[model samples]
Target: MDFDLTPPTEEMEKFRQEVRTWLEENIAEEMKESLDADEFTEEKYWYWREKHKELARKGWLNPTYPKEYGGGGLTGAHEAVIVQEMRRARACPNLSNRRPPETIMVWGTEEQKQKFLAPLLTAQMTCWQKLTEPSSGSDLASYQSTAVRDGDDWVLNGSNVFISGRGPGPAGGPDYLFGPMLTDPQAPRHRNLGYFAIPVRGPGVEIRSMNLIVGRDSHFVFLNDVRVPGDHLIGGDHQGWQVLSTQLEQEHGGDGGGGQALAPDQSVENLITYARQTKINGRSLGSDPLVEQSTEEAYIDSHIDKLFSKRAYWIHESGSQLAHEGGLSHLSDKVCGIRNANRVRDVMGPYGLLGIKDHLAPHGGTQEIQLRRAIALSHLAGSLNIAKVVLARRMGISRTQERAAPMRTSGAKAAH
Candidate 1:
């Protein structure tokens, strides 16, 4: 389908065609086969990783971001065309490229940008975020992890949990997992945070793969007294919070609107495909009235979320700084996670009630994993309660009002 794209410059279009041709020609046959088998071995994954860098080296992945920083420096319209083509091809975007550097480039110093953005854009090194402590979850500001300054180094001590895809997704690929951290202790709780572009592998950094309820192993990373140079500090020392908020704003939706990055949509599509194919009794699962209703609800929720998110993205792309509603982006992200959990749970049902593999009873497999994953979603993404809190706060309803009105119970109660 031809999308109403922002027309690319003639040169950009020429570059696009060249890229499409190159991907068709050079993306390895073995990697394609591995992706088909859902076998993301390090070797097969590296094939795709190399391809991402090749594109990056050519300035095709994030064109219009900035030429100096290894972005193509194209307009948003041009980016739309790139995204549309990648989607149409059923090929992944350069997932390894997007968020962290974009966050850094926007808020990092010229030195910070020079240090991280160029290498990131050129695919020289990979970075992962270190936020969300064991204690902090979605109340990220309350993080117990501290980056106290020690001479020219910042001694880091904390653990970040439920970080995603340290290896790859269903299809083999490199992980793009980078984040902001708390840097300045002297600043206020919200204001003292700082962002860092840390690699997945570092001397003091350790990532342990977690087998999720679903089939994948995301990671849990522990940073123990890791020493990062002061120059690696993004957006200055105490200004960490300033940089951190900008990154969170981007993560919640886009810079301005409520759009998320890639994974959420892919997850929804996966569930929808399952609904279309999986059957109960004689009828296709997609045909059953209840299934259809769930399907419609899922679709509606996904589209509404996407629309709001895209709107948010454009607002940010246009240099706007405010969410239309104060915490709408966070609320939208919360909705996306909950909807994903609910949609998958409704379709999968009692089987999903079974928890993780290690705890699986005699009759266990998909259901156990699904159920556990569904439960974990509430915690892994923003907690269900956090979403309500954001939504309540944004709507200008006091906590007392919320308690009195008695909104739906959160995942905490549902888990029981």
Candidate 2:
């Protein structure tokens, strides 16, 4: 197998230059300064929101999405160029919560797509996936959130804890939320659910910020008799498990057929820089064999994680059959993140624990945030143990027949 990096074509190079020029002319200095911030202020929030809208208007935000739905209608290579330029400028907008639009694209009726996907694609709305519940951690199929049909609407009543989104602050909360709900309790486990999207400001929907060790970005969302229009349901009733599996596949590191760019962990690089500059007995800390070894190990592990994601990206871009690759990428990210964080702490000593408020904190306390996030994210998406089980299932090691989750490509023909 050839492993050499292919140079971009001349036309692609020109497009890259165009994107670079646009960002240089448009991205504000204030946004660049706050790019590494752990939390967003009200002002920063609006700044990001407006900038995202600007990109959306230009079809650069979700470049590969269908043009009819407000995307750029570009190819995967074009999307890759946009992502590369955005990352280089350090102004990549956090337009996450992609599952809603993707699921809608694959399963929504024409009216549903026009109402929901259009706003999402245009950056007029932001969404959060309400999957995790107070009772169900990584066991998503066992969620207790229930949705009962009432005439032309669905009444949902349940609570989701540890929901990751920007809580109500200067910029306000998410515009919508989408996730699976128990539609048929008597049905079998995988066939008992239904997926729906509801506006966050709708009646009986409440969001409360949670005080966590790392940051306050997480929230507890409560839905009490929340009435959602029946048209909001995607993939039909009691077919949520199939629809949600597509989303889970993407969340667990599958590419969803979009050209994905690798965003390397800055903490590892920061630690290496610190070790080189730091002095111990008038000698560079990196000169110590133990410190050097730990730093090298961390860098190597992070590089491997990046490679895994790059491979997954290539697989999806090529439309090759994807199995166990996403699981491998996610598992490496979770395991290597914690391992690298420990290595950073071991190499930097107490300085690694300093927060952004500390005057002596290195790299604006980005390393500290990374260290905490490593621990927090281990339990997010899916726990490391659960990730292992998923990998085993995908690899066909846990069962005679491999249980590969179906992955639906957004904007592409429906796979179901």
Candidate 3:
């Protein structure tokens, strides 16, 4: 658990103790025991949702956001304590993180925050973002969804594919979902859009499942004249680009939560352990020099990802100008995911996936599952290409700023 990282200071130590004590007192004993079980079951998922709800009510989930929006109103330091404790317990974090709520808080009006965000922070509701279209994955700004104003309401019409939490799941259902659409198709590129909060169960909305090899519950959604209230508009009309930027920042960026700024790479560590124990060809798999080399590479890559992401989060929390750091951090994660999954699979050979649903396979054949996910993730979250472009643009901006500074100095001298 130590991982030989920086030691906790007095305040951090106290806070760590506080979180540990709170979990012990608040979490159900049976729930804790079930979480520790090897076999994942329906009960495990159900209890995980219950745990999420409990964390939401306690405001620990959105710790760094404003309390008015149902957040914990804690600083980045406080959030780090919560994350450390969760990891200390060896809990696998649910994918439903604080991003959805954080995005709304960034761009929503006071009324919108009251209507939508308050419910989210307290687990009274959940939300899904409709950004990725059937064809638009990396080119997210070129989404085909459209929203036409109809009296005081707006009519939304478009389709989205591969939506993560579309219909039903263990966490129940989402109350509403955010949609970004073209308000004026005739208007220029980024200026002709709008963002709206549409009801999931509302009329004119259609959703279908997208069956992936990893058994994820993603969906394809269609909106046909779905009416959104006037107040549902976020970031004002035709200002969707601004809202989108903020949303993506929160999605890809991490506000420093002390040391809990990034996800741990447990999969690699687990893979290494499996190889050390499992025998292949009458010898331990780890005995192979190639497998040992690949495992070491993966282990190092995992740690590097955490370090890169942590620095980016610190930049965000410090309110400094974010320099391609968010995009680069995210890019590293997705790329590492792809490389590690492939390398580990190759090292495990057929044993990693041979008996996927039977014995003899390592980690219950979850590596096979991870391989499928890694393939999908590589294409998701802005794609590796888009992330690269983001970083490049930041570099261009830096150069532009440098040039403008000298010109401004010359102009000041002339005025004098």
Which stretches of candidate 3 lie above 4 Å from their native place? 1-6, 21-50, 87-97, 166-172, 253-263, 279-284, 354-356, 397-416
Listed in order, each prediction's TM-score against the native is: 0.72, 0.91, 0.83
For model 2, the local distance difference test gives 0.79
Q: 165-277, model 3: which lDDT tens digit per residue?
A: 62344333356778689998888887888888888787888777677764545777888989988888887688786666656665553343234544466679778897798
Instruction: Order candidates by lDDT, high to low.
Output: 2, 3, 1
- In the range 1-416, model 1's lDDT, one tens digit per residue, is 22222456788688668656776786656655322222456675566567768777767676656687787766555566556555545454454534566566666667767777787777765655556777886777776676777888777777876666525543222333455566665667867776665544457777776565544545677778788777766666655555555455444433423222322355466567767867679767888888778877877676666655556556555554442332465466565656666776787675445443434321334334434555565554466676566556545575533211100111111110
Model 2: per-residue Cα lDDT over 20-74, one tens digit each? 9999999887666352444566676777777888898888998867789988887
Per-model lDDT:
0.57, 0.79, 0.68
lDDT of 1 at 53: 84
lDDT preference between candidates 2 and 3, better one: 2
Q: Count the backbone clashes (under 3 Å) in each candidate.
A: 20, 0, 0
- Cα lDDT of candidate 3 equals 0.68
Question: Which candidate achieves the best TM-score against the true structure?
Answer: 2
**Sliding window of 10 residues with minimal summed lDDT for model 1:** 407-416
Tell me the alpha-carbon RMSD of every candidate: 8.9, 2.7, 6.4
